[model samples]
Target: MGEGLDFAVKYPFSSAAKEILKSDGFSNITDEVVELAVNKIIDSLAGKSRKRIYISGAGEKEDLLAYVTARIILGYLRNRYITNKFAVNESKKVHSYLNEESGETVDRVAEELGIKTKVNDGMLLVPLPVFLKFTPRSPHYHLINRCITNGFVQIEKQEKKRMIEEAVRKHLERVPLVKKPPQKIISAAKKIINELPKQEIQATAELEDSHPPCIAELIDAVKKHQNLSHPARFCLAVYLIGIGLSDDKIIRFYSNLPDFSEKITRYQVEHARKRGYSVPSCSTIVSYGLCRANCGIRNPLNWHKGRRK
Candidate 1:
């Protein structure tokens, strides 16, 4: 039933995701993450009892697809980690999301199915580029990242075979084979946070509920740069959270920027990395440094620009 809501197959990726990955500046990142993802696929396939797979697409219809995908993937990961095996639980009913009335119809179907739907706020909302035709880039694409984020969806502009494999490689590091030491890991995180510099701590604390400064800085910087170029800010935004800055912080910070565009937000972070800022530094120094980097450069207070436009 949930699969009716989530799984997407051959959902094309957005231009943003594609452009970012193609950048030569991000070459170093591509290989490392790809290696990790490949290993995960190999490990999972080595002992799988079934070859069954599920798929879906995005948009207003994507809401349903996203929901279904989350449930199926969650169930599969749970089985994989708990019993070291893959389990099949496919949904038989399917629906469409092509019209404006999809919302009410979907609500009606849910009531009829007797399926209690949970408002999965914990599920991450991934933004797919508008270019993707017929489907969305939900968790099924990057199973590794989806696994790491704990059933959370990842936003992407492209769907590359290598990238999905790479995402899986990074995902394995988080799973616990036995009794997962939750307390120990928390303590370790606290210790690591404490060991970080004061600026980093402050920046992290401030960005706990919003987009990181590195992202904002990247956008602001890209706007200044005449050349439409590398690392594509979209990729940077995706990568920033992976570095540890909280989403809450990212959103809150973005709220402050004038004329901020998600498109711009996406490209900046990727471009910044290509320019040599590590993820941590991008979140901390570059995000903050951009203000200083742009200091004293005045626009002379464009009082007439609004009227001219």
Candidate 2:
């Protein structure tokens, strides 16, 4: 691999990554590529894909092609749970890699993605609109909560890196549909899908009917296999714990998330429980931009307090 394309291999969602794929004319689809792609999908479901990818110069093409192949297989399968999980997992890997990247490298990656970011007065500034576009899924990055001067948003490097996760997610989400894919691709997808765990959900211990409208909506998202915003996830977990739900059942409910990771979930849940955290007030939830409705209650817990199911 050329040194110029090295960044692309590391940040495979970059334009250079696409150019490399197009320039290389990748069509071999040998057993090695297929197997690697299969494992990529399986690792995603197994909660093993968050670790960043590594590649030697000699192996860059194989590594690059493997990612594309895995994405194509997912597109062909057209499974929402698998697609969203894979994108989130891959974006997380990008977020991990970005933390160690140099300032120049970070700016270059943003430029490649057309994010129009720059440094001024020792602060990294992003165009307000661009920042808002990618940060909708992340509440802390919500524009109204951020510091703005003139028309740009003042963001720390960590927040910039956080934006990349959403950018990468949207980029990967647009994988062109695979039509009439080769039998090799079809077979590989089947194997990948077969290996996916069937949700790993815990025993049913939900109290949804008794939940406030906002909490009820969050529970419904998990049941539908949708991803929650980080704030939303945390709010939901803390509220469940406040309601006297056990660790096991809360973890069980979260298992329905497409990117479910048992260790991480258990750790966060335990940490919150020990802190004796309760659900945020309806006003606080509104500040996080997750208020689902005006239930006329001051707190989520009260909306269902006397209506135990």
Which segments of model 2 are wrong by more than 4 Å? Answer: 49-58, 135-146, 200-203, 207-210, 258-264, 305-309
How far is each candidate from the true structure, as Cα RMSD in Å?
20.1, 3.3
Per-candidate clashes come to 45, 0
TM-score of model number 1: 0.18
Most lDDT-accurate candidate: 2
lDDT of 2 by residue, 186-279 (tens): 9998787566556543436556356777888888778777788888999999988887789998888888887778899999999999998878
Model 1, CA-based lDDT:
0.31
Candidate 1 error regions (>4 Å):
1-161, 169-182, 198-304, 307-309
* C-alpha lDDT of residue 192 in model 2: 71
Give the CA lDDT, 0 to 100, for residue 224 in model 1.
36
Per-residue lDDT over 11-118 for candidate 1, one digit per residue giving the tens place of the 0 to 100 score: 112222233324423323232333332232332333322222435322323332322223223233332321111111111112212122244443343333232222
